[model samples]
Target: MTMEANELRVSESVPVDTGQRRGTRPMAPDDVAAVGRLFNRIFRRHDQASDDDLGRYLQTVFFGSPHYSPELGSVVHENGANGIDSAILSVPMAFMVNGRPTMARLLCAFMADGKAGAVGAARLARTMRAARQDMCFSDNASPVSADHWVAGGGIVLPIQSLEWQRSFLPLTAAAILAGRHFPIARSRVLVGVLRPIDRALRRLRPSMRPKTEGECRSEAARVEEFLQCASAMLERFAIRPAWSPAEFDWLVRVASMNRNLGTLQCRKVVLPDGRTIGAFLYFGKQDAAATVLNLVFEEGRERDVAAAMFAQLDAEGYAVAVGMAQPFLMNAISRQRWLSFRHRGYFCMVTRHADLKEAAERNDIYIGGLASETWSRLLTDF
Candidate 1:
């Protein structure tokens, strides 16, 4: 059904002939309910949130983050300040640009797929670019939004969210085959069938899984150790987020916010000589599905890191293994079986600076599903 009226913003007290208005402004404390209603109106999911749940989510997810700022987000009021027409939420973050600490906006959750979609989108792009930030990028834009951003001077990097998985039973063959025929056999159905087989196989042949050869040792990783490993490993990328221990901690906390959800756990890899070669983090646990949040290691230590990860995961009894699809990690583990993958999302950027664009296109910039976007954080549990 066509929308009866487009949410219009006002540029001036008197209306213009073009009908384009400028009712863009930063979200405020009182605008919480309207924003929630708009989100419900745009994406119908999980039964509409109550006013309390919406308020709590706003305060916790949107306002609790270290980068929270009312001014960083833009909302349009088509029916005036009392209601919302459109909005795009972003969180300012620090990234390592050539190993230097730099600021950026991780854009997510937009006013697309709504009644006033076009006007809201254009308004959001304009508002975000005009905001005081070094760069604005997103890892959550769909094809429709991607086209819009491209036409509006945004750059879509050739970054993909590659996926890799291991099957514990013959049922896993369904997932492998499911990719070939889109929406054919259901994945959950396959997994459900394999759950019992996985249990049965573990008792008979514990070594049916691919064996890792090496003296690599993995232990519960300390926060500091993981951060140190990240510092050393990420230097290979010319442009990447300069991670902070606090932010990493905060991301973990956010991941844990959803009750009954899987967790993000860190593991450090060591050699026989007790040298910390690398560290990795993953969500979900053994006999269940899981995904890699990150895998950081030194330049020449890829083998050690990969071996240790495989051994650790195997020992843990994981029914399935998944990767976050970062190019560096996926390329390193290219020899493994990756039956299925998806366009994680488009890493589209809108920047006035040339260096930023160059760095991104050159693959100097390192980004992934977990490192950016709120939906990604929620989806990483998969």
Candidate 2:
């Protein structure tokens, strides 16, 4: 079902009929291939992405589950001769107000319909009503899609700023050398290092040390915990693979290439008795020299291990570190002296169905970090 431009034109002027029952349902196991195909079609049309990149994007979406319940997850399909002319996707993420699950951010979303906008809005309305209090919607605000949601009554939400990081430079050395202009040099190197690290680290597990007192005392304990959990779960947990069987190798390939970008460094955590309890991917160090990708601990150990890792880095005579605004984890790093905040600039826009005004009111959430289908797919390349 890789839709051609001519065929997609049929969906261009979607009917505005209020009674149309374009099926919007939870995505099933059988839906992965079709979903991947549709995603590729939309992204290729909009972003000029490559098939390889599109495959990677689909891999992230359909990996390892019979159904994805990202707090906000659904698929919309039209009943046409071709079947399912449009689609929408949502991933659930929680945001806290006073440490409560006050918001649910829609991490991924897509839509294809002109006439059934009302029906789509109604369904999202129902979904939002069922979600937590502070509901947030996020997606790439495409001109066409933005107009559609606006017509359906959804308002745009603003984002604070966009932030990103990579392990292309050791902040300590960078500061000693350049004084201030480190990131400019670091970004270029990250792109260059991706291929080489990708070839290595697949079988290498660096030595890790136990927590020191400083780490035990820091607020980063929470972040350390989560990092540990994510690592353990991703390893040896033996869940069914989420992405297409054919694409796993490609995911691995891309990951290998991007390893030096420091996005997938994970470490296993063992209990005192030597029981392998958890693991985590590490994050937050802009290291050009260490050759370590972003690291993660077991989800639950992020906060704890982070302080320990930082203490270790500082004790080893590292001078400075940069903390990107990566929510809770980075927030923890910002509190430490060896780490300082680096500011980057960009704003975000959120879009959702306009007719779901009541649901928006009830959910009271905002979505951010959403890229257009094009950009989202394109991200797979890097």
Measured by TM-score, the strongest candidate is 1
Q: Write the per-residue lDDT of candidate 2 for residues 1-382, one digit (tens) a residue.
A: 0111232222323454565534545455455556556655665444233355445545565443223342234445555344454565654333332223222334355644446445543454333332222333444444564454445444443222323222222332443335234545445564355424532532242211123432143222343343334433434222111233333233333344443233333344454554443333332224332222233344465555555555444433323333223343555444444233333332222323232334333333222221112113333332
Question: Model 1: per-residue lDDT, tens digit, 203-246?
Answer: 78665455554677899976557778887778878776676777
**Model 2 root mean square deviation, Cα atoms:** 12.0
CA lDDT, candidate 2, residue 137: 46
Model 1: lDDT of residue 357: 69
Alpha-carbon runs more than 4 Å astray in model 2? 1-23, 46-60, 66-72, 92-106, 113-161, 164-263, 267-280, 283-378
How accurate locally, in lDDT, is each candidate?
Answer: 0.61, 0.38
Q: Quick one: how many clashes does candidate 1 have? A: 11
